[model samples]
Target: MRLALTFLRINVMNELQYRANFFLQVLESVVALATGLIVLSLIFAQTDALDGWTRPQLLAVLGVFTMVGGVIKFAIEPNMARIMSDIREGTFDYVLTKPVDSQLFVSVRQFRLWQLTDVIVGAAVVVWAVVTSDGSEQGSVTGGGVALGFFVSLFAGSLMIYCVWLILTTGAFWFVRMEMLEELFTGLYRAGQYPVGIYPGWLRAALTFLIPIGFAVTVPSEALTGRLTWSRLALAVGFVVLLMAVTRTVWSWGVRNYSGASA
Candidate 1:
């Protein structure tokens, strides 16, 4: 924790040097939020509810999506990108020489502090949606259950994403042209902007079991909207554990096979 904090502090201070980026990020966040709101409005205008989700409920999903995306951009994506670059450039040896675990070091090395704007904005939107909806059509979620379930599910979801991302990034060990991974992941992540229930059965299953955007965005939104069940939450946690194991196995294998640029 201390080492992670040290790295975070350094990253924060370094990003603080470029204050203008903050405003740009804020602008970008607002524009994206506005576009989402417009889409929600259009969808609601067509009908009263979408597949069972009300406007405010969908809003909560959007908020979770935004917040999760912000987290990915702020930490996971940047770090993963760095690892890919290091692997390609032969500089990953420097990371291997360090005393810390390679995965831990690479994971915490880079932080885009400005990307946090989306997190703050998304949280605000979620609070607003919760207040406005008041569990109407969503569920009767209230009291401590909402907070506890939301946070727990959110953490698990984010960690699951990180694990999957690392597993993909680990492909750098064998494949030199891995840049498409980022674009592909980003494209698939957009599916999280809405409730997975609206999709066809097969796509829903793919998102939940194959890709995990369903767990990442939908489960947390379900928690916030009082729709999450204890069993499903348990399923999410179990799935994250499974993904973690897979990620570790893949990373270790990759490292063992990697000959580095010098080799």
Candidate 2:
């Protein structure tokens, strides 16, 4: 945690040198949020509910999507790009020689501090949606349990996403030229902006098990909107543990292989 904080502080200072970038980041965040809201409004105009989700519920889902997406852009994507570059350039040896865990070093070495604006905006949207939402359609989630569940699910979802990115980027050890691999994740994540239930069964299954878009966004949204099932929450937690173990094993193998090749 201390090392991560140091990296964050350094990143903040570096970003402070370019003050104008702050406004640019804010503008970009605003544009992205506005675009999402506009599309959502158009969808709701034709139908009162989306896959049985009311506007407020859908908006809550969007907020979770935005917040999680911001976290990816802020840390995972940038660091993953750096790892790819280092692998391609044969400079990853520096990381291998360090005493710290290679995966931890690679994950937090670079940060886009300004991208946190999206997180702020997304959190605000979630609070507003929760406050304004009528409980007519939702189940018995009238108290703070919903909020607690939402946050717990959100944390688990974030960890799952980080694990997924780690697994993907670890492929850089073998496919050094595959810098664009992260783009695949970015494209697939767009599908999570709405509830996964509206999609066909196959697609919904793919989202839940294959790419895990359902766990990342929809599960948390369901928690917030009082629609999350206990079984699904357990499944999400199980995925988190399983993915974390798998990613760690894969990362270790990648590091070992890279070390062998370098030696």
67-139: candidate 2 lDDT, tens digit per residue:
9888888887888889999999989989989999888888888899998998998998998888988764354
Task: Name the runs in model 2 displaced over 4 angstroms.
Answer: 136-142, 261-263
Tell me how many clashing residue pairs each candidate has: 0, 0
Per-residue error for 120 in candidate 1, Å, reads 0.2
Each candidate structure's TM-score, on Cα atoms with residue i matched to residue i, is: 0.95, 0.95
RMSD of each: 2.1, 1.7
Off by over 4 Å in 1: 136-142, 259-263
Clashes of 2: 0
lDDT of 1 by residue, 72-136 (tens): 99999999999999988989989889998888888999999999999999999999988888574
Error of 2 at 5 (Å): 0.7
- Which pairs clash in the backbone of model 1? none
